[model samples]
Target: MITLSESGVIEKIEQCSNLDSIASLEFYSGILAPAMVNAHAHLELSHLGGVVPPQCGFSKFAQCISKSRNLFSEDECHNAMDFYDSKMWDDGICAVGDISNGSGSFETKRASKINYHTFLELFGLKSCDKTRLNKLSVVASELGLSNSLTAHSTYSLNCKDFDDIVQSNVEGILSIHFMESEGERVLYDGFGELHSWYVECGMHIDFDKYDSPVDRVISTIPSSRRVLLIHNTVLLESEINSLKGHFGDNLTFVLCPRSNLNITGEKPNFRLFSESGCRIALGTDSMASNSSLSLIEEMKEIEGVPLATQLKWATECGAEALGVGDQYGRIEIGRRCGLVLLESVDLIEMKLTSLTSCRRII
Candidate 1:
């Protein structure tokens, strides 16, 4: 039984088979778990929903986003953000680790009932935005949200890009989109379509500048700090082994299966990551690249993993990634964690069937 105070903070927890002894308590037969967490999301991009084409390769998709991001008016984007926030809440997402290229989602986040950790995502094609992070941090702080200055991806961030970002978020949760597509292999030998596009756009870079894009990113961030590596679609097994040995305590992997399939028609090598026994989480990248910001679709699409493990990835691991484990991951005393009920799934067998759906309770 969960005892929630009037203000929604959990006061006590009783581990029992039933709460039948409690006075006038109505109970149902369902499996209770912590509310899900969309560990990596771009709520500000909600306005771009249904605009970008599906199954477009990463390079072309990036171009489409850049060209169409400013098509909507400011008011329209704000409305879309609010609507998307409600959709996540309706789907029982208690917390979100959302990425923000700018401070556009600040007001909606401030008014949201769900918990949010804002990531000020920085990017530069050939240079770094070394000076604008402090101002962005102030905006997040004023809105009363946990914020971090994070890198967008391994390809875009350069040596000069993270001077301010690394210092400001030295000890916070740092997230990066790492090797999300096969095209990212160009950084090593300049062979992929992404490299060809770079040359076409006149964005030249020395492929020999670093051993790998992952190495270049890891060197800039402190090893002691927690780093969430999002999108491991193209990372090699050898690279995973090396990083696991070096950054075990501070590394976590995040998968957005639906987004990956929607863009590249393939998902990450889940078996590879699962065998490593690394901490994992789930997310919906953005509406621009996905059908909707629902974590359920991601959970359903992710196969080869056990249902219990997938649920843990969607909830507890996500909470841990967002730095809210003690308060939001599990159903425990004094946690104040939101709760949801899993319906239609086989509780006895602990399996997720096609009929499975979630119902939010608290």
Candidate 2:
């Protein structure tokens, strides 16, 4: 049996015995675990949920977002954020590592019940103004929001701006979009669809000084800071070894399989990550690239991973990656880590089936 205070703080946990049966005790059918965490998301893009089609490939999807992101008015965007924020809460997500390009999601987050760690993402083919990032950080801070300045991706920023962000963010956790698409993998070789697209847009990418994207990342980002690498859809085993060897326990690989499968028609090799024993976490990228922001739904796409390991990815690992472990990852005494009851689980096989669904219990 488990008990909690009025405010939801756990008080005691004891295995129920036949003599302890009490009329007031409640029982629930299905698996009970801590509330899940969404390690990476774009709440600001909730307004473009169905606007971008699925399986369009990364390059075309980027173009679609560039065109459709501003189609809705400010009020409409805010409404979408509010709606999705509630959806995530109802879906039993207790914490999130959200990406924000502007201060658009700040007000919604300030009023949200969910814990949010906003990543102010910076990206540009040319040198980005460092002051702009600081200004955004100031905005987030003024709103009393937890935030950190982060680079958008390895291929999105020029070498100077990317290096500056990496070197200057001496505190707080950092997240980056790593090797998500085939184009990005080949862009380091100076020949890919992404390279051609950059040329077509008349933007210059100064990345030739580095040997490869992995080399640039290793050389630029300090090993001291906690970093979350999002979307290893195209990451190689050797690259994983290099990263694991360098960052050790300070690094986390966050997977958004559903979003990746929707956009690029490919997902990460869960088996490889499992075999490597890396600290893995889960994410639902954005409604713009996914059908829903539900972590349970994201969990359904993960294959070749045991159910227990998957739960850890959805809960404990994600909470640690977002730096909110003390309050929301486990169901220990003194923790009000919201309880989630997962229904329709295959108890016989110890797996989550297609019909599995979750609801908040505490």
Candidate 3:
């Protein structure tokens, strides 16, 4: 039995054979594990649940999101954020990399029980402007959120916008959607089925106007800054190798398995990442594209791998990617005691059911 104080410190941990050994327990469950860290999620778009439009390609999905943005009301947005925050807490998410499109969810984050670093997302396809950048900085500072510039995706941003985001010089954590689908890779390489779709949508993208988006982004962004590259389903061997060489300990790949399957019907090459010495993490993404914000579900979807490795992706790797490793990832002395208790069982069953709701005692 272990007790976590109100300040998130571990007060006591006593080994026991039965439930009666612990005194005055408020919550009881099976096995106790360290609290989870969700590496990537867009909380601002929580209001658009169940609104994912059927799209054949990544470009079509982008267009659907663009069109659906206007349909949400301010109150609905607030309610959705609140609902999602509560859900995360109930599911034992101790820390999160929450992407905020605006300042509306600031209060919700401040009041939530979890430790959160909100990334203020910014994107402009054609050109960059200092005025807008300054305004975003001020808003970020006023809200007391971590200021991060995130490019929407490789295929979505122009070079000028990408450069402006990189030059913000407000460095802590950098995030970007990388190769999520084969179509995205093809579009960036200037030979995809979406070429006509881009034209039909009135987006005049001259593939010759810029270099490869992945290469260009990696070169422009500082290698020293800790990066969380999300949705790397189509990332090549060469790109992973380059990242390993340049950003030694500062790079992490965040896999959104549910979202990847939903959009592209494929999963990332976990074997390649495992063998390449690249750290990996997991995320639930936005409810708009995913069915829920449950890391347990994400874990189940990617089961059959070693249990220890999967747990590391959900806990330590996520903390490292979000720049909170020293404080929140592990269950060692001097670290915060953000923990989850699971239903007690034999070691084999415990490993298999640790992430399920039936096993959780947050």
Candidate 4:
């Protein structure tokens, strides 16, 4: 028998002489473990499932999503959010760093039994200036969400817009979609498939506008704030090494293997990040890009790694990434009782069954 304190700490582990001897004692079966921390997710995009691609490149897939966004109804969006939230609970997720485009899902998130902190995403080629920032601040204040800020990825926002967003210095967490696809890399480097796609889409192409996308954005952003970089499917070892000097303890990388595979059919260099001492976390993304909101499933899709390492990504690493490592990641005393219980299975079987209905005790 194990006793986990309310603060999520493991107080005691009692071993009975035998199962029959412990019959009089109240005990829960299965594996008692720490609650999960989902480091990145777009809950508002859950409604566009099959409408997106099952096996399309990132650029085409993104185009499909843009085209389908207006087709969804308000009630459908609410139902999709509810379904995704329920799925997270079943997988033992206690906290989530969810991203919202606006104030649409604030009521749904507040009514749910999960701990949610939203980052209002802001991105535009020409409109994410002071005017947009002020508007976002007013909306965020009205919703009463504690933390809100302007968000941008390496390939999305221009230099001035990125600077303005960072300059606002909003509280809570700052998240951005990093190198998730080849298109992003191309767009940043000014010489890839996505650059041409951008030009073809009628978006302005200003090659001399700024230096490399990563360098400019990193230079302007405050490194003290906790930053979660999602996907990073195309981030090279050298790039990770360069950030080592700049990122201190406030930067983390979030791996969304299922979403990566669904979009670009590739995975990031996990071995490199693990060896370089980079902080790492796991995210299920959303139902639009992924099948379900199951961190265990994300852990399972990670190939060529040990189970212990993968488990760390889903638990401790994610908590650390979200700046709540001390409170929710592990089964330690004084931490909240956010825990999971997995069914007994061999290592191989455990990995395979992690995605479905493996036992969960939160």
lDDT of 3 by residue, 1-362 (tens): 56667776776767767876657857554556788888888888888777875334566666677789668889998899999988887887888898876677788887788788877666545544546645765776776665666666666666667666666564757788878877766676666756667666677554335456566666777787777889888888888998778878888999998887776677887777777788899999888788888787787677456767877888888988888889776777667837775443346644655435622343
- Using all chains and alpha carbons, the TM-scores for the candidates as numbered come to 0.93, 0.97, 0.88, 0.89
Local distance difference test, per candidate? 0.83, 0.90, 0.74, 0.74
**Local error of candidate 4 at residue 134 (angstroms):** 4.9
Better structure of 2 and 3 per TM-score: 2
Q: Over the stretch 1-362, how does candidate 4's per-residue lDDT look in tens digits?
A: 55766644677767757866654666643455677888888888888877786768887877787788779899999898888887787778877888877666777777776677677777866566456645765766676654467565766676666666776665657788888876776675666767777777777644335555567556777766678888889888878876666776778889998999888889887788777777888998877788888887787777766667777888888877766677777776566747687655354544545423444564
RMSD of each: 2.0, 1.4, 2.9, 2.9
Ranking the candidates on lDDT from highest down gives 2, 1, 3, 4
Residue 265, candidate 3: how far off, in angstroms? 1.1
Number of the predicted model whose lDDT against the real structure is largest: 2
Clashes by residue pair, model 4: 7-334, 7-335, 7-336, 8-335, 8-336, 9-332, 9-333, 10-332, 10-333, 35-338
lDDT of 1 at 272: 83
Residue 344 accuracy (lDDT) in model 2: 95
TM-score, cand. 2: 0.97
Error (Å) of candidate 3 at residue 320 is 1.3
Better of 1 and 3 by lDDT: 1
Report the alpha-carbon TM-score of model 3 versus the true structure: 0.88
In angstroms, how far off is 266's CA in candidate 3?
1.1
After superposing all C-alphas onto the true structure, candidate 3 shows an RMSD in angstroms of: 2.9
Residue 161, candidate 3: C-alpha displacement in angstroms: 1.9
